[model samples]
Target: MLRRARIGLALGGGAARGWAHIGVLQTLTEAGLAPDIVAGTSIGAVAGGCYVAGKLPELEEFALSLTKRRVFGFLDFNFNGSGLITGKRLCGELDDHLRPVQIENLERKFVAVATEYGTGHEIWLSKGRLVSAMHASYALPGIFSPVNINGRWLMDGALVNPIPVSVCRALGAQVVIAVNLNRDIFGRGTIVPDHEATDEGPQGLEDLARARSSR
Candidate 1:
């Protein structure tokens, strides 16, 4: 469906760009699917701000730079900690799951997808290992860090976290879809199922083995 949408936009002279974090918002608006109320998680807040402020033209570049800074912060923090940073994989997975759930469970949960920035999700999740562990065990990637007194994660675009403006007033904020980007690189050591051994990150038979062992 996304591919089709992208193709349709491209065919119709619409600019279709792929973004890791803020791109989701860009694509939505570019495709003329803007939400009535906008809420962003972590770096996504920048995109939200752009949308609300009528700064669509600058959103793409802003998001790119913001994400670059975020990745840099992840790298910087990784050296001092467990040497694992960058919430790309985790955030990517959460975005995948939340896309469907948001439409389905919008009334019950305020789904927000966050990414790593200056402080990295590792440091954030460290504050609540139990919650982090729960997310990890369920394969639901997310940084289990609670927002500060203001209920916000610090990142680029500005220091203070901004409250999301709802496109629809009826749906109140209830759930946040957090994306955690912290963990040791298990490398080829991790296993997969129903496949031969290979130099891949927990693929094939090894992946299944790890899943079973976790059980």
Candidate 2:
């Protein structure tokens, strides 16, 4: 009997940069690389969830249809909470794409990571509602409100594990391939020295003591 090694794909978080994941997944498909398990954090959850649910093309269509005004259309601003956007419209779109499906029912294993708000701990969502997990994983603190699941507040997984390679290992993957989108983002930017860069404060022992005490 021949057995195949279980391969896991790890997706990283990077706001709008996460869009590149669609191309990555499409390329992987064209190359005949099918992962047994998928683990993702933050925006990675959205992409991975779509892939696991076999709705990648639909998600790609939605992404391709976005414009500046159309992007803003998803924002339902509310000043009552930490985040400015309600995120209801965006959630509705995700629900339209991946709802009515359970993680347990998926053909392959999928994991979405989120950060426990106050505890600053990693929360791995591997079962239950798929869309809920995706929503929780990418809910940025100051942009979109944190999601409350089982009485615990969860924000973006980027706060903890942006690329969940360890999560893939824990899930019994024999091989893990991680994609990080936060690389080389600053390469094209110039670092111009500002006047504040030369300022050094609290040189003396007394001033240093005062500064330390203020904290």
Which lDDT tens digits does candidate 1 get at residues 1-215? 33321110100000112134355545665786635334333334323333444444555554456565554553322333322443434334334323222122232222122222343321111112121211222221222222221122322111121222221122332332221122211111111111211112322333545677999
List candidate 2 segments past 4 Å from native. Answer: 184-215
TM-score of each: 0.27, 0.83
lDDT by candidate, in order shown: 0.28, 0.79
Instruction: Name the best candidate (by TM-score).
Output: 2
Q: Model 1 misses residue 157 by how many Å?
A: 19
For lDDT, the strongest prediction is 2
The CA root-mean-square deviation of candidate 1, after full C-alpha superposition on the true structure, stands at: 16.5
lDDT of candidate 2 over 1-215, digit per residue (tens): 88989999999999999999999999999999999999888889999999999999998999999999999899899798779887779989988877687877889988888876887767777767788788888999999888776555777888778888878887889999888998622111111110010112312433433665698
Each candidate structure's count of clashing pairs: 17, 0
